[model samples]
Each structure stands twice: as structure tokens, then as C-alpha cells.
Target: MARTRLLFACLALATPLVPATATAAPLPASGLVLSVRQEMGTFSTTQLSCEPAGGLHKNAKEACAGLAPVEGDFTKMSPGDAMCTMELNPTKATLRGKWRGKKVDFQEVFSNPCVMHVNTGKVFEF
Candidate 1:
């Protein structure tokens, strides 16, 4: 009788931890927060939300359009038609957040700000 009572108590304690439904919580449509850091240590950040295209980014609409072709895959972005110098002023860009309800994390380093812009276009233009 004591073992049965203990088992019931343990089961009661563990029940709440289980989800009532199999479906997970819904995710936001699309969003991403990005940052860029120069070799000199200065950095800038911006937020981008797609679909309706609104955020703190100065070129949110263009950025969203740039991301659309690549489906938010930064590495697949087409290089812009910009002539960059061979200057080696390293810069790092990072993004973290969600895209189309899926989590995303990305990072990359470029030879310079100009190169960064050439590679990522408006997505990192902030």
C-alpha cells in the first residue's frame, strides 16, 4: 500500500511536465537581428522583420527582398556589383533570430566593409 501511494505521488508530480498536445507553440513569421563589427572594435546592430517588411533597419524592404531569393541563407546571397579595394580591414557580421518560423544563426568575416556589402547587399547594409 505504501509503494502504491508513493508511485501515484511520483506520477502526479511528473504529469505536469508533459505537454497536453503534440503541437509546439507557433513561431513568428520571419525576423532576424543582425550585427556587424569592424576590426577596430566598433559595431552596429539592426533588426529586420519581413512579410510586411518593417524594422529598425534603414533598408528593411530591400533587405527583405535580398533575403527572399536566398530564403534567408546569407551564404547564398549574390555578390553585389561594387568595386571594392584590396584593403584588409577585416569585419565580422552575425545574425541570430528566426526566418519563416525556423531558428537561424549565421556569422561571417569579410576583408572590409566594402567587401561585406558586396557579399551581403542590403541585409548587412545597416
Candidate 2:
């Protein structure tokens, strides 16, 4: 009788209060996965780790394809009307697009697994 009660209690406690799948969507872009995101005067990229593909130098080309970014003007236009483009190679990542007739460039790092880093005017390591 005691074993049965304990088992039932354990099962009740194990029940999930909320569904596990209710979390936000995973970041669309990943290492070497080139993605574009734009807002007002700035465009940014999703930082991805290149470790899973056997390191950056070896798999840089393949990883670059997974990087995804979203582009749009938050105040002026819809997402479809914005223009954003990225060029990433084994060496650097470059972003170019027009926001309300102004140019915006954004960059980020994918090299280390410690933390995400972003910069402008230079190609970052992945």
C-alpha cells in the first residue's frame, strides 16, 4: 500500500505544469547560417557556433549558409518591403541594405562558444 501511494505521488509531481514545447522559437540563423534582421537604422545577425560542423576553418563555407537575418523597418514599412543582403565567406561577413534611403551595416562573431559578439566595419571570426 505504501509503495503504491509513493508511486502515485511521484507521478503527480512529475506532471508538467506547462507544456515543454511552448517556448519561443529557436533563433532562425546559426553558425555559418547567414541571416538578416533589420530595424530602423541598424541591421543585425544571429550569432551561431561553428563548432558542430568540425570547426570554422574546415566547415566555414557550409556553416555560412545557415546564417539567417530578418530585415524590415519597424516604423515605416512592412517586412516584405525592406531590402537586406549579406555576404559571408571563410574570412568575413558583410551586410548591405537600404533603410529609408540610408545605409545600414551590421556584423557579429561566431567563433567562440563562450558568448556572442557583434561589431561593425570588420569581419568576425567564426
Candidate 3:
């Protein structure tokens, strides 16, 4: 009985010294963030420097961009028979692709303020 009591007392004393751990809340589906370092394109490439916002940029100043869930969830993006064609310009970037028999277009209204040279009319098959 005495040994058991001593163990209980030691446990009680040590309990106060234990640090509390913080639990982080999960990200929302509509606002999910993807930290993409660069345009995940063809197998081989040199490098390009740009970054995106929305808490998904790994390195905002070093070729890190983000994919945010605006109209759809990230899980909804399945890897299938889809072809993405990009058009690069001095002022804008346009992306058009066909996924699941539906045509989709994404336009980047704002160009990279730092001005990274991106190739135009490149088709990436995912």
C-alpha cells in the first residue's frame, strides 16, 4: 500500500511539470492550400523563380507558388487523362485544359511582378 501511494504521489508531482501540446485545426476544403515550389511540369527542366500567396508558398521569393481551393476542393483534383496548355505573355498567363470530358480555363490576371520568363504554348499531360 505504501509503495503504491508513493507512486501515486510521484505521478501527481510530475503531472504539473508536463508541458501542454497544441493541436492544430485542419485546413478547410474550400480554402485548402498547396505549396508548389515551381511549375510541376515535364520531368526535366532548369529552374524558374516565382511565388504565390494563400499560405501555400514554400518560398515566396524563390520559385514557390501555391494552389488554393477556390471553387473546388484539392481532393477533387484527380490525376487522369488531362492536358494543360499554357499561354504566357508579358501581362498575363492563361491555362486551358480538358479534364473528365469538360473544358476548363484558368487565367492568371497578374503577371509575376519580378518577371520570370515562362514558356508559352506548352502542353503538359498529367
Candidate 4:
């Protein structure tokens, strides 16, 4: 009984040292923030809200339509047929925010803006 009591005392002390866990809040139903940065330090960003399809994006409806087919998987987006020069301008693309209640965070670097546009299509054309 003395050994059991000692173990219980040790556990009681250790419990206070354990770190508390934090739960992340659930993501919004449908929205995304898209951006692109160029090697020259120029960048642009825009908000995109789907479902009803509206935001600061120039063509939110078209962008959302393209995303729907891929279910928000940017990597799986069909590449467009736009021809691009081989110049290495170094453009970085990013996408973050929620889509259909799912969280999304994506980033990629391309040779140039043309390549980024061809790869991402209307979703990042804002």
C-alpha cells in the first residue's frame, strides 16, 4: 500500500508538468487566398470565395469552376496549353485558406509567370 501511494503521489506531481494541448478551430466552408511573387520582388494577392463564387478575384466564377473539377487539389489541376518562353524569371505561387470545409495550403516555384499561369490556370490569374 505504501508503494502504491508513492506512485500515486509521483503521478500527481507529473500531471502538472504535462503540456496542455490546443485544438485548432475548424476551417471556413469555402474560401482561398492566392498569391504570386516574382524574382524582381513584385507580387500580387487576391481573395477567392467559392460556392456562390465571388471575391476580389477578377473571374471568381471561372476560377471556382476550374477548382471544382480538381476538388481544390492544386497539384492535380490540368495544365493549360499556353506556350511559355524558357526564361528563368523565378515566380513563386501560393494558395491558402479553406475549401468546402477542408484546409488547404500550397506553394510552388516556377520558371516564370507564363509557366505559373499555364500550370495554375484561371485560379491564380487574378
- Per-candidate Cα lDDT values, in order, are 0.77, 0.30, 0.27, 0.76
| All candidates: TM-score | 0.76, 0.18, 0.20, 0.74
- TM-score, predicted candidate 4 vs. hidden true structure: 0.74
TM-score for candidate 1, please give it. 0.76
Which predicted model would earn the best lDDT? 1
Q: Which residue window of length 10 is worst by lDDT in model 3?
A: 42-51
What is candidate 3's lDDT per residue for 39-112, written digit by digit as tens? Answer: 43311111111221122223323222222222222222323343434534223333322222234444442233
lDDT of 1 at 80: 78
Off by over 4 Å in 3: 1-68, 71-90, 111-126
Off by over 4 Å in 2: 1-69, 72-91, 112-126
**lDDT, model 4, position 59:** 87
Query: Per-residue lDDT for 38-76 in model 1, tens only?
Result: 996676776777876777789999998998888888878
**Model 4 segments beyond 4 Å from truth?**
1-28
- TM-score order, best first, reads 1, 4, 3, 2
Say which prediction, candidate 2 or candidate 3, comes out ahead on TM-score.
Answer: 3
User: Residue 105 error for model 3, in Å?
Assistant: 1.8
Q: Ranking under lDDT, best-scoring first?
A: 1, 4, 2, 3
RMSD (CA, Å), each prediction: 13.6, 20.0, 19.5, 15.4
